[model samples]
Target: MTAIPAVTLNNGVTIPQLGLGVFQIPDAETRAAVTTALEAGYRSIDTAAVYGNETGVGRALAASGLPRDELFVTTKLWITDLGRRAARDALRASLDRLGLDRVDLYLIHWPAPATDAYLDAWQGLEDLYAEGLARAIGVSNFLPEHLDRVVALGGTVPAVNQIELHPALQNRETAAAAAARGIATEAWSPLAQGAVLTEAPIVAAARAHGVTPAQVVLRWHLQQGRIVIPKSVTPARIAANLDVFGFDLTAAELTAIDALDRAGRTGPHPATFQG
Candidate 1:
């Protein structure tokens, strides 16, 4: 854990570069999975209002007996809760569900770009951050246009932008925009939903590094300066994912991965996120 690095956000806050993502993790398994991650030395946990397991994650955190400040928790606002007032109420509900008086980082899960309400939703987050209900604020799945809006309105630049990222969908432009604005980048599906685990280069790199293919890929992201959240219910994989601090991928290896990018996304596109 001590060997893991930290990324400085636009607000000058330092967060763990590698974190645990509990996306689609069943409610029954959420506690055990998050607890396993925490015990294995992960201090940052990324969840969302839509994930439907906030209570379980909350219970795990409470039961772990770890000091709150040492842990960084990130959660998001759902599309249905996009208006200013509705967003405010939604965050309070999320706080109640997570059993946290204030979250470390909060984000707009998606801009719902089709609608014009994300700006209002972002204002809600800004208000929350100003009132100390959230230590930091950011967005998720926001394309460059959405980010430009956040900046144009004249408020705090997002501390991070959690997005769909993997070797197959590198999101170079979005990541570069975030970097130019000093926003930290977090990858939600760093493993590509297990679709790329058997890719030749990943497998070869895994053998070359004497690590699992997953670890090799995660290390590649780490070396490329991206925050990653690799999810797993299995304890061994959870432990292995956090063990990436020990290695660094070569520039050529990273270039090989960059070439693997199909500009293909396996998940919903941000521009089409209606809710």
Candidate 2:
């Protein structure tokens, strides 16, 4: 057990700084992946309705025998379901599939700006939060402009903003904006999808720390106060990802990694991504 640190969101709910992400894992494979993560001492599991594996995640959680309160489960509302009522219905459906009464955190999967339905979705999330169906609500892949608009609409400020952030794509500007509004930034691709594993800085740091490159990259995210959900289906990698809390990355090492940022976004642009 690595004793993963917890970050208290703007609303005062605490989330584990590191968690398991079930993005591409299929429904059948998701169960075992989540099971491996649980057995490896992970309490948080991040999934999206679009991922199409909440049912498998739910099955694993139900079978774990761990108290429901001890786990932090998060799922998102897909772009297709962006209206207020649609978002509400979508969550209920996700809840039904997950076999849970309420999700720890519910997020609008993306801004989907072109469609102009995110504000409505935000309202639905607020309604869910008000009714206790979602403990906390947030938006993912939202840029600074999107965040500003959501704030202007004025119902509930998002507790977290999930984005594609890694050493290669640090996304500091949006992160700063989220921080200014007291929202925590959650990094989805914290390891650059393995693109940065062989970088000289990361490799050097890993060798110095006697840890793997993946662990070094994860440690970089953790050391900077960002919440990370690194996805890995392999049991060894799943267990290794959580073993980053023991060592600290030096300031020079952090700076070297910071210099690696080149706006290399691994996902679609939020402003234009309809889905």
Q: What is the C-alpha RMSD of each candidate to the true structure, in Å?
A: 1.1, 0.6
lDDT of 1 at 64: 95
Kindly give the stretch of ten consecutive residues in candidate 2 with the minimal lDDT sum: 112-121
Alpha-carbon shift of residue 41 in model 2 (angstroms): 0.4
Inter-residue clash pairs, candidate 1: none
Model 1 per-residue lDDT at 98: 91
- lDDT, model 2, position 85: 99
Expressed as tens digits, the lDDT of each residue in 57-117 for candidate 1 is 9999999999999989999999999988887899899899899999999999999888789
Query: Model 1: how far is 230 from its true place, Å?
Result: 0.9
Which candidate gets the maximum TM-score versus the true structure?
2
Taking all chains together, the TM-score of candidate 1 against the true structure is 0.97
Question: Which portions of model 1 miss their true places by more than 4 Å?
Answer: none
Task: Indicate the residue-level lDDT of 135 in model 1.
Answer: 92
Candidate 2, superposed: residue stretches over 4 Å from native: none
TM-score per candidate: 0.97, 0.99
lDDT, residue 255, candidate 2: 97
Evaluate all candidate structures by whole-model CA lDDT and list the values in order: 0.89, 0.95
